[model samples]
Target: MPKGFQAMTPHAAPPISVEGLRRSFRGPDGRPFDAVAGLTFRIETPGTIVSLIGPDGAGKTTLLRLLAGILTPDAGEVRLFGRRPDTNDPEFVATLGFMPQRFGLYEELTVWENFKIFGALRGVEGAALETRFRDLMTLSGLKGFEEREAGKLSGGMKQKLGLSCALLSEPKLLLLDEPTVGVDPLSRRELWRILEAMRTRTGMTVLVSTAYLEEAARTDRTMLLSKGRLLAEDAPDALAQTTAGRGWRARALKDAEEARLARALMHDVRAASDSPAAAPWLDAVPHGEYVDLLTAADHTRSGTPPRLATDAPEAHLEPRAPTLEDAYCALTFPETRAVHAALAAPARRTDPPAPTRTAGNPLNAQDVQDAVVAEGISRRFGAFTAVADTSFRVRRGEIFGLLGPNGAGKTTTFRMLCGLLAPSGGRISVAGVDLRTARSAARAKVGYVAQKFSLYAQLSGRENLEYFGGCFGVSGRALRERIDELTAGGELARRLDARVGELPLGAKRELALACALIHRPEILFLDEATSGADVCARRAFWRRIVDLARAGTTVVVTTHFMEEAEYCDRFLIQDAGRVLALGTPLEVRRRAGAASVEEAFARIVTDARRRNAEGFAS
Candidate 1:
């Protein structure tokens, strides 16, 4: 038996305990804010997997840091196995394994070298080190990539290597902070499998934080946090059952009216709340072909679906089995729920269309309607091909998705399309302008939001917006007008004067999108814009994107959330720098014979890997 499996078996005490935890940090405005306020929880069982979930700035990360002995709480106490967690205690440190949101690995080092270094730091060396490395590499599917440079590995591979390093010491307690963020669905499943297997073999306790509610629902226990307080904690099923009667699914008469219908439903719910005889608070969001509705528990409409006022095609409402997300919304404040639903509300019918080339144009396209076109595009760095012979076209006002597993060249391809990187071969055009000969002209018609926050952190949101608007040549009255248009009476308006870094995850995301739209460019590029946002924030973000596409702005986005792919009009899937699938979401689902995009994505990627190992042409 391996040392990791044997090392954690002798201990019998509970892995974690905390009471009245409190932590605070100074905001960008020089004001103190409680990050983890009066939180208390205990995990009594060994070998249990507990999921920590919350919206942005809900103190999930702060709680993890406090438990890891990296941060001292202003108040309250934490006990690991009935002893205080002290950073200077070697025994305590050795028994705990922590992987932060961004795992710190020497990017320039090879996978084997990185593993060896982390092992030595954790006191694992010689034969013991070799055995541990072999076991972890095999389990993580990284055995063959030992010689690969850590920097060159795909996102998924990097995550696996990080996990292996964290686990080198066979710790009894493992802490993973959003370990699966920004990776493909296939990689996410593999990571979870490794976690489950590790717990089974070693009886180690695991605490992980994630934005994916469905992922949290699968854990042995889930703790939902909001505003630095524990809102609810229980087994996943128990928590879900709390919202049993609040969930409903409503489908529009026409499938294409789903978004519009959802907007109308939410709008009616909000408006009714302000009237003399208003209905209870309700949340509505578009879900593929239908609109998902969750009503607050009200005896007036306890068992029957509430009627909503809307000009959209009549919708049929049916009861939906409640999930963890519905439960989360139920516990959240009414203001938060209102903000989410309100932001996603559709534009007023009296408003003018956004200024874009494709506005008022039909979906059907002739050759001249192509907003973006790439032919046999390829980018090679030295001997390695990042993107190979990729070809695709984006129609005007269309939402096109570029998807693939980590390190599969999605970024490279996206850069080529944006005229940020010169492809080694093939032709490309943006907004009818040739990228090869008129790169500057092509770039002028597009706006890009990077995967990471690229705006000035110290500057106020309003200042950042002004700066970006100036760069894009919108100034004086024009820039002010644009800022007002983006921030008028919503979440953005509330956070506009605050420093950008001080804003919560959702507000920061909104600011980023607001900056991207300041120029009203014909094309918008978003690279995982909603990667860490909560469910409500994601729904709000997509609603804005759908509205953009409707007004003739071409949107090219890359996201790891497979369900987000369903929002794309058309998308292409790539792996190992090769195009494996390309078509509408329904078409791809049919090809793989899978029920959901995530399932199809996993099946397709697994099949491709198997074929490659069998020496078949990819």
Candidate 2:
């Protein structure tokens, strides 16, 4: 048996296989939006995770649903272990496990109860059910609180329970739809651990859809779904190799200036808009944002978007490896607004440098102070000490990140930071406003995008903004102006009048961020706001966030991607509700002696866990 991500004995069979699949959804006006058109993929080896990556409304969910036998595609073929998937094969259905983006389980049931009921539904009972329950409980790290009601479980735990339930029958096929969206980084890793473990153990094939490009890159193979069609399908490495022969990075202007550069490069004789940038790239010459192909000597002018500069010492150059992210951008032909703007001529800044520090009273109308402050804060739930004395702060114009493992108290701490729950003890302020004096006022000074698409799905983007603006007391011209400002610019502006519910997952998230920033709050609290979005959308969303941060809006973001951690000015790692490490991302990783920020967080928590054990084990 594999015992890692998939466990399959010789008795095991191929878990899933699909052929020429097609699907569509009813548009807002009742037109058909072909989501998955003529898609084809196979799951031959058990325990291999295959991802369907694309923009939202790309039919990822539809494909998964079709495989789960929950929905029949308009035209296609699917088989689970050599049997047609949509047909009712009690044995196959019983053996297939699915975790939808919105998985449904009885909210009132205790974790154990839900597990048991699911087990029973699949006809596992008596000692077998008990044993399965015990194994799943441990595998999911769901011990010590089997009695915790489902309703009481955090988002991460609930999803874990859903997964455990899915694994209860030991299904030969597993399907997961963006299960780690709002889950903290630590939790996200733990979930992956379980995923890998299951794959290594069962040899059961797992097919999943994901918003994280890194996740897609890690999969054995991937399908790039675009507006109802299969854009590409191949190994991630092969996909990246398409542009691997020529790859380089060049420094461009920052923010609005960068936008200008991107726009200029977009129309410039070649190339178009790409997405997202943080930190600075090495200065290059010919002295434009793009790596002008004509500027490059070896360049064959094929349809391939030309590569930027590398090793041009006169260009103050630095060479780096091409990333899967870069490959995705290239293959997808992502818009290069950044490149375009980078190519534009520089504009001199006549004004002198502004003051480096600005502090205002928490009660003042001008929130010119630091974005967030925390000191010796702790949270406790009854006898359980969730978060211990944690302290960190974020200055204006910085992207501050918070990371931790699952069950590490990241969410608990977040709730406290958001004032959704009061800290058991601590001093905290947000956007120069003390959370205690007037929570609403403090909240008003900050923009927040929750992990879930909590916006009114039924409302059009315009109507939703109006209502949310009303909550902020913006009316008449002010409200309209604010709304216009939010939905302004590139892709999002085009969807202002579209129904929020009808928008793709990526568009909805973008709209949410725009809505949160409608009032131009001094700081933005993005609590895992990019989790279930499709790849292109996620990139576009991040581009917007970078724009916000560069515009001097203090941004505090929580995310599962380590690469994203690179964007932050600094970060704090939390585990079991305690701050374990704090510093610049590079510093923290160096201190932890780990290769990546995620690895550093794992190291810190491992150290903390060891300390806790030794301190208490007598």
Candidate 3:
């Protein structure tokens, strides 16, 4: 064990114990709704890792705040170390470290300065503080970058820095809320290693909430919540075993056909069942180039399983081991199916209106032309080159993806494409207007949704839509019509009048998309649109994007979730301002000699970095 954590020891009581907890908040309609309702659970072990998971609005955040003593429960009891928690108690506060979804780090300060300040505020100072800070920097891989400003750090580095600051006090109990939401896969692995190392060395307890089920499966225990109640709690492997012999993988499926196959399978299952109890499949969801199907117990026992109706000679089905995600879907499919049915209505615009040119732009709207063109584009700041000699073409109505690790210049390239930043060199044309000559006119033909929330928090959803519509030259009856078309009979329609600040994370994401689409531009850009969303929400969001692309809207997107890269017609991968690979998903995987996009991405980036280091040494 390291000397820094040697002073820590396991507590006598379990880390957390809750009994009949309940909390409520008023809705926009002025009615009370339970956020955390009548929940009971206990963590019986003192030095174990536990994962809390659920869909949006499942009260995961509320429950975490309650356990951390940041919020008071309206009904029952919450105990820490066998005693009720009091936030005002210094000793109690010293024993706990809570990193909320947004850690309050001083953006203007240097990384080292931020750590020193946080440590001193927690009563660690002088040489003792210096030793602890060095240990944390080494653990977080931020040792050589101490002078970097916090505001300028990459997404992964910022998250690592936040984790380091949270550990300065050496709290026995750590609460992390979605710590890896927007982080890259490599950084996520590093964060988990740090957590595991801490637990193994010092016997500290960790309670983390995550949107990624794969992360949850690594923990000692998993607790699944839904609508403020605990639906299931058990070891992940044991939970997965409950769905044994029912999981199947579909082979020989194509990207464009996967969605249609899933929908068809759902429809056939519903039609084949005369009664609710006669359904043959629980759910069918697209997983990359294949589908993951959860067969009904009775269907599997009867020696017959569902099959796809396709002419492909190699199409086949094979049994696969169940996973934590399979268990989660099995437990929640009935309720989720109903909610999805309600939300999927507005996104089913298969024959949407054709693209129209923005007023004052002379470009002809055609499906065959290249929607975005860049030739040897580069951007440099002071002595550093952010993007260098990059070139790509995006076909109209195509789904093009921009992919890279944090600080790899993907955002810089995206900003140049959007005409938000002028390139330092090279030629670029967007929507047939030369970006150098008419940046504003080119911007008028494209709609962009940023990586972070960019809407008015205090205004209602309808008001924000109205505000953005007017900015795009839409007005009065036309603006109202656009809003109606965007929200009619969908999830947004139900939350239309709610303040943007008060809605759930998924709802907020959808509203941002609506605001961006108000102008009906020829092209759309989405940056990490579903970074913090649950699996169901991501599927729904992609469905909308797919339909839009089918209806002649050119789409460019950037996401950290590698699985989402499969949805792109073609994608470009870059690192350190240079292109690594650019091709279809199949071509990229073949070039990298990997079976999946995630694996290909890792292999590509690792190989590039290794080659660069070797060249430098030579």
Instruction: Quote the positional error of residue 50 for candidate 1 in Å.
Output: 0.6
Q: Going through the candidates in order, what is the number of backbone clashes in each?
A: 0, 51, 0
The TM-scores, one per candidate, come to 0.89, 0.79, 0.87
lDDT of 2 by residue, 82-120 (tens): 777743667867778888876567889998888778887
- What's the best-to-worst order under TM-score? 1, 3, 2
Supply the global lDDT for candidate 2: 0.66
Q: Between which residue pairs do clashes occur in model 3?
A: none
Clashes of 3: 0
How much lDDT does candidate 1 score?
0.80
State the lDDT at 274 in candidate 3. 34
Off by over 4 Å in 2: 1-15, 44-47, 143-145, 154-156, 196-201, 249-323, 334-369, 415-421, 438-441, 470-482, 489-491
Model 3 ranges with Cα > 4 A deviation: 1-12, 253-289, 295-303, 307-314, 334-339, 346-368, 472-482
Best by TM-score: 1
- Decide which is better by lDDT, 1 or 3: 1
Worst 10 residues of 3 by lDDT: 343-352
